[model samples]
Target: MSEPAAPADTIPHGDPFAIFEDWFAEARVTEPNDPNAMALATATPDGRPSVRMVLLKGHGPDGFVFYTNFESRKGHELAANGHVALLFHWKSLRRQIRIEGPISEVTPAEADAYFASRHPESRLGSAASDQSRPLENRQVYLDRVAAVRALYPDGNVPRPAHWSGYCVRPEAIEFWHDREFRLHERRRFVQSADGGWTSTMLYP
Candidate 1:
């Protein structure tokens, strides 16, 4: 199915965060799968880069938030290189958001709260899985989960110290929308010294 036609007003002016919220709300209704899914790009100190899909667990004026095991590959890269990028592509809406920023860890209390809110089985899996690490066999992981279950029979898995979240404090935000005849639309905003954003458009 084709996306709805994007008129001139498709890309709004003013705060990019507000614009993101509006589009995300639409995506929640239109997207068939995880609408909050986004591509996270991180790089090592040597400049080698890696990209992965992660859920947008939280977002607001502070910036976009996603959780992971701090010992994971992406986490290590983020620690080595604070600069990062994020992309949100809602195919059903034919809209995308590109964000560039430096990351900061979410408070431990916040991580614990989010962890506790997850389903019991999900908590168990997250607690047991050694993310971004090689495993010998599938049963190895299953056994770990079983062990955790045995220890926490009530399924009250405590959030691992390494499992936490990071927030991207965006320095730039670009919004893209698909248009007919292959004439797309793009609007970018760069943060100013006073914390306000200066806007501009790019040929697309």
Candidate 2:
């Protein structure tokens, strides 16, 4: 059996980004599956909310990044409303992180680089997909994929103008750690006006 985690108080009081890096490093070793998977929450202009899972392609003090079809439902929502939230839950560690921020599109160069790095099959699928659109049948989608594959026989699919990435500039980040007896520990960090972070502990 695995050993229990140290007390929450042991978590250092320092830069939240630094703390995040440490936790993420540990998660990479312990998680059984996609350790970078995160839940992205986006809302429509009218306040209607929706969420789906996405992989974290990059992160740092600047923000977290993820790629998707620009015409997808989430993409449309993001264009209409920049504000969003993200959640990272690591079951193996009994911990989760919540981030709220405003998103901006990544540079075209960045998008092209990441797109080029994708597996040939994945590139073809993304290039062929009309994300968030209704499909008449599975065969129709498969046929589209085949057509794309035929056009780019070498699988050097170009990144579509509508396919790109977004970076979330976090304004708030909260860390939650579960403990025995239902006693949890929570810490929230919010960006200040001067571009620095301020944090506080919450009763959990």
Candidate 3:
């Protein structure tokens, strides 16, 4: 399917955050699964980069939030390099968002709260799985999960100290909309030194 015709108003709002929220809400209705999914990009100590799909669990004026184990590979990368980038592509909507910013961990209390909200099995799995680590066999992970289940038989799993959330306080945000004749529309809002956004339209 092709992209819809561009509306008269192509200029995103003065606040990129608000524009993001509007598109996100639209995607929620259009996307088949995990509408808030995004590609998280992180870099190793030597500048080698990696990208993986992750859910965008929260976003607002505070910034974009996602949760994971602090001991994971991405977590370690964020620790070593505070700079991070993210991309959100909604296939159904034929739109995308690119964001770059400094990453920081969310509060421990916030992590605990989000952890508590997850299903019992998910919480247990997250606690048992050694993310980004090599395992000898599948049984090793299953055994660990079984052990975790036994330790918390009642399914009241506690958030592991290593698991938490991070928020990206964006310094640059770009919104892209597909257009006919291969001339897509791209607009970027960069954070200015004065604590405001400078909007610019880029050539497709």
lDDT of each: 0.93, 0.94, 0.90
- Give the Å error, residue 65, model 3: 0.5
Cα lDDT tens digits for candidate 3, 26-101: 9999999999889999998799999998888888867899999888898889889988899999989889999999
lDDT, candidate 2, 4-39, per-residue tens: 876657455679899889889999999999999999
Give the clashing pairs for model 3: none
Q: Which stretches of candidate 3 lie over 4 Å from their true place?
A: 1-9
> Ranking under lDDT, best-scoring first?
2, 1, 3
Q: In model 3, how large is the Cα lDDT of residue 186?
A: 93
Deviation of model 1 at 60, angstroms: 0.8
RMSD of 3: 3.0
| TM of each candidate vs. truth | 0.95, 0.95, 0.94
Error of 3 at 106 (Å): 0.5
